[model samples]
Target: MPENGRTDTGPTAEPMIRLEQLTKRYPGQDRPAVDRLDLDVPPGEIVVLLGPSGCGKTTTMKLINRLIEPTSGTILLDGEDVTRADPDALRRRIGYAIQQTGLFPHRSVADNVATVPRMLGWDRKRVAGRVDELLTLVGLDPDTYRGRLPRQLSGGQQQRVGVARALGADPEVMLMDEPFGAIDPLTRETLQNEFLRIQSELGKTIVFVTHDIDEAVKMGDRIAIFNAGSGIEQYDTPERILTEPATPFVSEFVGSGAAIKRLTLSRVGDVPVPDWPSIGQDTHRDERAAAVRAGAREFLPLLDADRRPLGWVPADASGDVLDRGLPIVTRIGPGDSLFAALDAMLAANSSAVVVVDDAGAYRGVLDLETILSTVHTDAGPAVPRPGTVATPGTV
Candidate 1:
């Protein structure tokens, strides 16, 4: 388990999964689909294998699930060698989700989800209760969708049911191969958000495969970019890959809109804010006027002794003494993504938002001017500053 209590002790001493010198060769193929791939997936992180089709991403995923045997090397699950384990036994302990969803056409939704539990010889009452519980957990009403067949639900709903089926036994690790690829854009985004929520609560170590760069960026804690024949080209945090592509192939794969993508991952704290003058409640009107004369702006952020924000103080006020609620105050946290700050600013009708720390203490403000200027600067790369960790619920 991790120190923060965000991970599980089930796989504490060893990686949730590890592929050491793994490779795969088709019957008559000249080269292996995957080449000596070595990777580690921590207990609560989602590691995405991203590359073009036939780049061995899918082949690598199947090898983990035992759907495809590795031509060479070993696969360890929670420190035990899976290569020698019974295929059914190994699969029962790992959740698997794929593009087609693979729900049984003849079985009711609830019964389909209950397949694993039934196959494992769970009690009748236990299977029924788990079916209902999982149905609700995946956003399907037990009374409404449980009795229906797989053909009865929408494509997106079917995908959700597929996820529910994979999670039936509460497997510690998940293997998702383009699970959202068959759905529409809006549905895909919805599923992605729901998956993120579920992963947070469940703390499953997930290995996700995708060819889309955007999906890779959005859904991965760390991305593994492969170059088909070259093995794993680069494996790093999404921020690092977007900011500093490990190779020319990686840079080209990420494309030209990388800057725009960075904005979504970068937080307000990553950009430097210009110093602005602020007035206190105790300042006299004449003195406030003097400070205003020194600076062009009339409004400033008022902070408490701990550098926590109180509110914005407007210059040329009527009195020297001020009370709480004298200034307008509404802000987002410093850890929020830049997109969130932008949204807050839009909704508040303000140019900036006072950035607060985890304790709600104000740190600084983020404005359009600051964000735009930073984007325009000759900054080498938009590396997430030290001290920033993945947001607890984010992939």
Candidate 2:
């Protein structure tokens, strides 16, 4: 056994599921659906198979679940040869979710979720309990949603049921083919977030196929990019692919706004936040004036007695010290996405945003210039210089 929770004995550790010289061809087709594919998905990892349509990403996923028999090559699942296993028994142990949901209209939500467990000869009580548990796992309240038919629910709800059903048997391996593709953008994003949260705890070895580069970047721990004829162009993490494309084809496929996409992955608390002059609301007018004069950005953040951010006032503008600055309706917290910060800035029509802690204490500020600068440089937080313009990037 490896020590300190590490695997060893060689430089390379065996993957949970490995595809060796995997290929697929259809009769009368001009080319193979999947060609000479070699990929490794480690346990407790998500490997997104990303490419344009007809790239054979779906075919690769289908091969794993035995929906499509591979023309050649072997599939090793936990070092076991699945090619010789019974397809029916093999599929029961592997969960599958797809774009259309594929829920049975005649079956209730609970029944749909209970399909695999029942097929596996689980007791009726056990299947029912597992159905409720899986539904709750996917954020559906079994008491409310269990009896509803597929058509009674909205598209998003149906997709949730589909996910719950796929996870019904507690499978260690999951295959998802654009499970959120049919839903609207907002719902799709919500599902993606919820799914990621589930994956974080469950740690299922997942093969997710998608044509959307943004989805791949958001969902993948590592991504495999497929080219024409189902050939893998590159296989690497999202960070590497975004900052360093392996080839011209990858650069083109990722499209423009790659940098902005990286911002979505960043959190406000990941980088060091700078400090600026702040005056307690209870402070005397003269002290407030002094703080304003010492402010870094054009505005000074007013804090309460506890140093919690209240609002802002122009550093140079004169006003009643007791009277607060412009009312800030929106605030960004440490957990907020940088993309969210940019959106908040655009919505507020402000050049800079005040950063605050959970207790509303002033942390720092963010602006376009700061975000742009951080993207280019690897420098740490800047020390405050009185009367200096502050740009908090990536903080």
Top candidate, metric lDDT = 2
lDDT per residue for candidate 1 within 83-143, as digits (tens), equals: 8789998898888999999999999999989988888899999999999998998899999
Provide the RMSD of all predictions against the true structure, rounded to 1 decimal: 7.2, 6.8
Candidate 2 structure quality by residue, lDDT tens digits, 214-241: 9998788778888765777778777667
Highest TM-score model number = 2
Q: Candidate 2 — what's its lDDT?
A: 0.79
Between which residue pairs do clashes occur in model 2? 370-393
Steric clash pairs (candidate 1): none
Number of colliding residue pairs in each model:
0, 1
Q: What would the TM-scores of all predictions be?
A: 0.74, 0.89
Q: Which 10 consecutive positions of candidate 1 have the poorest summed lDDT? A: 1-10
C-alpha displacement of 236 in model 1, angstroms?
A: 0.9
